[model samples]
Target: MDQLSATLLSAPVLFFILGALAAAARSDLAVPETIAKGMSLYLMAAIGLKGGVEVAKAGFGTELLVALAAGLVLSAAIPFLVAPALARFGGLDRTNTGAVAAHYGSVSVVTFVTASEVYGNTGFAIAGFMVAVLAMMETPAILSGLFLARQKGGRLFAPELLREVLFNGSVVLLLGSFAIGALLGERGFEPISPLFRAGFTGVLCLFLLDMGLIAMRRILKTRALTWRLALLALVFPVINGAIGVLVGTAIGLDAASAAALGILGASASYIAVPAAMRLSLPQADAGLYLAMSLGVTFPFNIVLGIPLFRWIAESLGGML
Candidate 1:
C-alpha cells in the first residue's frame, strides 16, 4: 500500500495522469510526434547501454541464461493461453484474437522502464541481464501470433515481414546500444554517462506524459474496444505477472529480478507487436488491439501493476 501510494504520487506517474486528463478533456496540449519518437529512441538506448554496462561489470552468468530462457518461454506460451480466451469469451475473430494475444505475450518497453524506476526508487537492484530478456521477449510472440493467424496456403512470414520483425528499429537500437556499452564498460562509459544517466528520469516523465495523452485519445476514438475486451486488458497483466513471479522465484532469481520478470509479463506490447501485426495480420483490427494494449493495459500497469508485481515477487521470495 505504501509502495503503491508512493508510485501513484511519483513525478512520472503524475505527469501521465495529467496527460490523460488533458486528453480526456479534449485539450490542445500535445507533444510533437517527432520529439516523442526521439525520446523513445533515447530511452531505449539509455536502457540498453546501462544494462550492458552492468553486465560488463558483473560478467555473464547462469542467471542471464536462465532468465532469457524463462522470458522466451513466457513470450511463446502467453499467446497460446490468451488467444482462446479472446475467442471464447471476448468473441473476437481468429485474426484479432491472435493479434491481441500476441500483445499480451510481448512487452511494453516503457512499462518496463517505468517499473525499473519504481524498483530503483524502492531500493531494489535489477540485474543488467533483464534488458537482454527484454530484447529477446519482443519477438517470439510475434512469431506465435503469425502462426495463429496464418492464412491457409500462405507462408507464415513474408520475407519483408520477417525482416521487419527481426530488425525493427527498437530491437536494433536496444541490442546495438547494449553491445556498445559492453564494449565500453564502466570506464569507457564515463565520458558520456552524464547524458544517458543523469537525464533519464526527466525524459521518461515527458515520454510518459505523451503516452498518457495518446492512450486516452485512443480509448476515446476507437469503437472496436468492447467492454469484454477492456476487462481482459485489465486482467491479463495480473494473471501473467503472477505466473512470471512464480516462475522467477522457482528459478532462484533475486527479488528485484523476479519482480522485473513479472513486470515484463504484465506488460503488453504497443510498439513491436503492433508493427509486426500490421505486416503479418493485416486483417486484424488495429483499433481494437491498440486500444486494449496502449489505452487500457499500459495505464493499468503504470499505475497499479508495477507495485503489485513488486509485492508479489517479494512475497514469493520470502515464501521460497
Candidate 2:
C-alpha cells in the first residue's frame, strides 16, 4: 500500500494523472505533436544509452544471455496464448485476434520507462542489459502475429512489413544509441551525463503527461472497445507479468531485473505493432487494437501493474 501510494504520488505519475484528467474534462491543454515526438525520441535515446553504459560496467554474463532468451520466448509465445482467448471470448476474427495478440506479446517502451522510474524511486536497480532484452523482445511477436494471421490468405512475410518491424524508428534509435553508449562506456557517458542522466526524469514526466492525454482521448473517442476485450486488456498484464517475473527469477535475475521483465511482459505496443498490423494484416480493425492497448492496457500497466509486479518480484526473491 505504501508502495502504491508512493507510485501514485510520484511526479511523473502525477503529471500523467493530470493529463488524463485534463483530457477527460475536455480541456484544450495539449502538447504539440512535434514536441511530443521529440520527447519520445529523447526518452528512448536516454534509456538506451544508460542501459549500454550499465552493460559496459557489468560486462556480459550468463544472466544477460538467459534474460534475453527468456524475453524472446515470452515475446514469441505469448501471442499463441492470447489468440485463442480473443477468438473464443473476445469475439475477434483470426486476423484481429492475431493483431491484438501481437500487442500483448510485444513490449511498450513508455511503460518500461515509467516502471524504471518507479523502480528507481523504490530503490530497485534494473540491470543495464535489460534494455537489450527490451530491444530483442520487440519483433518476434510480430512474426508470430503474422503466422497467426496467415490463414487469412495474404503474404505472411511481405518485404515491407519485415522491414518495418525490424527497422522501426524506435528500434533503430534505441539500438543505435545503445551501441554508441556501449562504445563510449562510463568515461564517454560522463561528458554527456548532464543531458541524458540528469535530464531524464523531467523529460519522462513531460512525455508521460502527453501519453496520458493521448490514452484518455483514445479511450474516450473509440467505439470499438467492448467490455469483454477491455477485461482481457486488464487481465493480460497481470498474468503475463507474473509469468515474466517468475521466469526472470528462475533464471537467476535479481528482484529488480525480474520486476523489469514483468513490466515488459505487461506492456503492449501501441506504436510498432499498430504500424505492422496495418501493413500486414490490413483487415484487422485499428480502432479495436489501439483502443485496447493504448486506452485500457497502457494506463492500467503504468498506474497499477508496475507496483504489483515489483511486489511479486520481491516476494519471489524473498522465497528463494
Candidate 3:
C-alpha cells in the first residue's frame, strides 16, 4: 500500500496529474510537439541501448529464446481472447472490435518503460532482454487483428503496411539502438551513458505530462464511450495482466519480467496500432478505440495496475 502511494505520488505520475488537471481547468500549459518528439526519440534509444547492453552482459541463452517466443505468442493470442468481449460488451462492430483488440495485444512502450523504472527504483529486478521482447511484441498483434477481422487487403501482405508496421519509427529506433548496444556492450556505452542514463526519468516526466494533456483532450472529445464499455476498459487490463503473469511465470521468467508481461497484456496501444489500423481497418472508429486506450487504460495501468500486477507476480513467482 505504501509502495502504491509512493508510486502514485512520484514526480512523473504527479506531473501527469498536473497535466490532466490543467487541461480540465483550461490552462494553457503545454509541451511543444517537436520537443515531445525529441524526448520520445531519446527515451526509445536509451531504453533500447540499455536493454541491449544487459543482453550483451548476460549473453544469449535459452531465456532469450523463451522470452521472444512468449512475446510473439502473447501478442498474437491476446486479440482472440479479447475481441469477442469487445464486440459483445462494448457493442462495437467487427472492424472497431478487431482494431481495439490489436491495441490490447500490442504492448505499450511507455507502460513497459515506466515499470522498468519502478522495478529499478523499488528494488525489483527486470531482465534486459525484455527490451528485445518489447521490440518483438510490437507487431504480431497487428496481423492477428487483421486475421480476426477477416478483412485482408487485395494482398495478404500490403507493401505499404508492411513498411509501416515493420519500419515504424518507434520500432526502428528501438531495434536499431538495441542492436548497437548489443555490439558495443557496456564499455562503449560508458562515454555516452551520462546523457542517456541520467536524464531518463526527467524526460519521461515531461513526456507523460504531455501525454496526460493529450489523453484528457481525447476524453473531452469522445462521444462513443458508453458506461459498459468504460467498465470493460478497466476490467480488461486486470484480467489480461493476470494472464500475462501466469504465462510468464510458467515459462521460467523471473517475477519482475512476469509482472511486466502482465502489464504488457493489460496495456492498449495508442501509437503504433492506431496508425496501422488507420491504414488497414479503414472503416474502424478511431475516436472509439484511441479514447479508450489513451484516456482510460493508459492512466489506469500506470496508477493502479503496475503495483497490483507486480504484487501478483511476486506472490506467484515466490510460490514457485
Candidate 4:
C-alpha cells in the first residue's frame, strides 16, 4: 500500500494532473512550444543515456532479446484482438475501431518515461534494451491496424505506410537516441553526465505540467466519452498488462523490469499512432481514439495503473 501510494502520488503524476486541470479549466497557463519540444528531447536523451549506461554496466544478454520479442508480439497482436471487441461493444465502425485499437496496443513514450522513474523510486533495475523494445513496438501495431482498416475497404497507400513506419518523428528520435547512446556507451556518458543526468526529474515535472494542460484540453474537446469507449479504454490496459507480466516473468525479468513491461504494455500511444491514423485512416474519428488514449487512459495509467501493475509484478516476482 505504501509503495502504491508513493507511485500514485509521485511528483510526475501530480504535475500531469495539474497540467490537465489547468488546461481543462481554460487557464492562461501554457508551456512555451519550443521549451516543450526541447524538454522532450532532453528527457529522451537522458533516458537513452541512462539505459545505455545500465547496459554498459550489466552487458547484453539473451533475456533482453526475449523481452524485446515478447513486446513486439504484444504490440502486433493486441490491436487485432481488441479492435473487433471494441467495434462490437463500443459501436465503432471497422476503421475507427482499428485506429483506436492500434493506439492502445502501441506504447506511450510519456508512460514509458514515467515508468522509468517509478522503477527507480521502487529500487527496481530495468535493462537498457527495453528502450530499444519501446522503439520497436511503435510501428508494427500501426501497420497491423492499417491492415485491419484496409480489409474493410479503407485506403492504405504505400507512401503513407512509408511515412508512418519509417519516418515518424517519435520513432526517428527514439531510435536515433538509442543508437547514439549505445555507440557512446560508458566512456561517452561520462563527458555528458552533467548535462543528461542532472535535473532529469525536474525536467520531467515540467513536461508533465505540459502534459496535464494537453490532457485537459483534450477532455474539454471531448466532453463525456461514451461509456463503452471509456470502459474499453480502461479495461484494455489491465488485460494487456497481465499478458506483459506473464511474458516478463517467463523471460526471467527482475521485479522492476517486469513491472516496467506491464506499464509499457498497459500504456496507449497517443502521439505516434494518432499521427499515423490521421494520415492513413481519414474516416476514423480522431476524437474518439485520442480522447480515450490521452485524456482517459494515459491519466489512469499514470495515477493508478502504474502502482497496481508494480504491486502485481512484485507479488508475482516473489513467487517466481
Ranked candidates, highest TM-score first:
1, 2, 3, 4
**Highest lDDT against the true fold, candidate:** 1
For every candidate, C-alpha RMSD to the true structure in Å: 0.8, 0.9, 1.4, 1.7
Q: Rank all candidate structures by their lDDT, best first, as comma-separated numbers.
A: 1, 2, 3, 4
| Candidate 2 residue-wise lDDT, 1-320, digit = tens | 97799889888998899899999999998999999999999999999999999989988888889999999999999999889889999999888989999999999999998888888877887999999899989999999988987884466798999899999998898888888888899999999999998999999999989989999999999998889999999999999999999999999999999999999988999999999998988889999999999999999988899889999999998998
Better of 2 and 4 by TM-score: 2
Q: 70, model 1: CA deviation in Å?
A: 0.7
Regions more than 4 Å wrong, model 2? none
- How does each model score on TM-score? 0.99, 0.98, 0.97, 0.95
Clashes of each: 0, 0, 0, 3
Model 4 Cα shift for residue 83 (angstroms) = 1.2
Q: Model 4, 1-320: lDDT tens per residue? A: 88768875888988997888788678999999999999988887778767767676677888878888988998999898788778788888877877888898899988889888877876776677788788888988898888777864445667866677778878778778777777788888789888877788889999999988887788778853798888888899988887887788878888778887888889999888888887888788888888999888888888888888888888997786
Q: Cα RMSD for candidate 3?
A: 1.4
True-structure lDDT of candidate 4: 0.83
Clashing pairs in 3: none
Each model's lDDT comes to 0.92, 0.91, 0.88, 0.83
- Point out where model 3 deviates above 4 Å: 152-156
